[model samples]
Target: MYFTFLGTGAGVPAKLRNTASMVLTMPEYQGDAWMFDCGEATQHQILHTSVKLSKIKKIFITHLHGDHIYGLPGVLGSRSFQGGDDQLTVFGPKGIKDFIEMSLSISSTYLKYPLEIIEIDEDGVIYEDKYFKVSAKELEHGITCYGYRIEEKDQPGTLLVDRLKAEGIMPGPIYREFKEKAAVTLPNGRTLNSSDYIGPDKKGRKIAVLGDTRICQAAVDLAEGVDVLIHESTFSHGMEEKAYDYFHSTSSQAAQTAKAANAAALILTHISSRFQEDDHLLLEEAREIFSPVYLAKDFWTYKID
Candidate 1:
């Protein structure tokens, strides 16, 4: 899995940053990607990266702010023009359906693929499949905003090849049967349980991606024990009052939340244009409260291991 920041600026597009947008690429999902937020010029940003419009299977909108959603219609329409026939799903707050529909309708944009828009009125598991489960919780953004948690399902353990070899079972197609079946009967008429020849299950990774918001309990809950916590840090350390006034979070507050949640690492994004030159100060503020903290930049990609 990997996280690629398409645009990380807050409020408006700056010379160095665009706005709010990121892509989560899942190698296990056949190269499919999930987009979070579609700020203005987001499709343009994708042109500079390996992200494909056709490969974006889902879009998760944080809020209805222009910086977070203005590029959504363009992305959706362009996907069709690019011959993306796969079904696409979008999840967002209640008014998102109207915003998307209105934009596409007024522009007379036609999609070549099926589109499903889900307006989240409450918080819970919004999506689930065999490999992953996505849950949402409301955050303290003044407006209806959300934070999402992506939990990858645990995988089956590896087959004990050495033990099988000790039992005189050489590597062959029959070894595949040991993994697929609960019990495998050898050529010698010995029945062996598959569990006996398997190691412990591999724990899945968890990630939390939050929308623009002030420090809140919901953010901590959504990020609990996450391997990666992507949070917004719109201001520096001394701007706590200003951050709270604007319904945003400071670098220190974001780090505090990560520390409280016990997150393994923290990535601070949604940076304000004012701090473009002094961004290092923001990073330093966050690292004071939490270790392994990163300040995200546009087009930067982080591999999740």
Candidate 2:
């Protein structure tokens, strides 16, 4: 799976940035992409990228802020207009269902596809399947906002084909049975334990995407030990007072959360329009506290190994 940032701006769109929108593509894992926060002009941004609207299987909205959800109506309409008939599920806060219904109703739009809107009320495992599991936690925001934790299931390790071959075991359908079970009896009445010929179990990756909020322990809980932590840094350093008043976070505070949570990587997004010309300041400030920190830009792609 991989992540792509469609827009990384704060409240308003600037010349260099648009707003908050991202895609977590898992073609091999889920056969589609999962979107996070479809901000204003998000569809326009997708036009410049390789993302397909039909490949969108799920959408997660962090909050009901205009900047984070204004593009929902357009995106939903366009997805149907583009001949997308696949099932789509949206997970968001309590009022998200009303917002989507009202927008579609006011515009008189019809969808060819089945849409499932889930309004999250409590925090727990919101979604789970054979390959992945998703959980959410409430965070500190002006409104009821949430952060999501997406964890991929652990994969089986590689099979030691060479070791088995050395032991007079030939590669065939029997190898499949050996890989699934601890023992396999050969035609000659010999048995083998799969564990002795298997490598270590490959751990899966974890990702955390948080909404607009001040520094809080909930954010830390959402991002604890995650491989990738996507947090918002709406202001630069030395702007803690302004950040607090606006219910946002500074670069330093974001880095602190990442550091405290022990995240492997921190990506700071939702940049303010004031720093349109000097966005590097935000990255530089965040890196001072967290060595593996990053500042997201529009259309930038982050690969998760």
* Best candidate (score: lDDT): 1
Span of 10 residues, lowest total lDDT, candidate 1: 178-187
Whole-model lDDT values for every prediction: 0.96, 0.93
Candidate 1, residues 1-305, lDDT tens digits: the string is: 89999999999999999999999998877999999999999999999999999999999999999999999999999999999999999999999999999999999999999999999999999999988999999999879999999999999899899998999889999889988999999888999999999999989999999999999999999999999999999999999999999999999999999999999999999999999999989999999899999989999999999
The per-prediction tally of clashing pairs is 0, 0
**Candidate 1 wrong stretches, greater than 4 Å:** 170-173
How well is each residue in 1-305 modelled by candidate 2, as lDDT tens digits?
78889999999889989989999998676558999999999999999888899999999999999999999999999999999998999999999999999999999999999999999999999999987899999988899999999998888889899999999888899889877998888899988788888888889899999999999999999999999999999999999999888889999999999999999999999999999889899999999999798889999999998
**Model 1 TM-score (2 dp):** 0.96
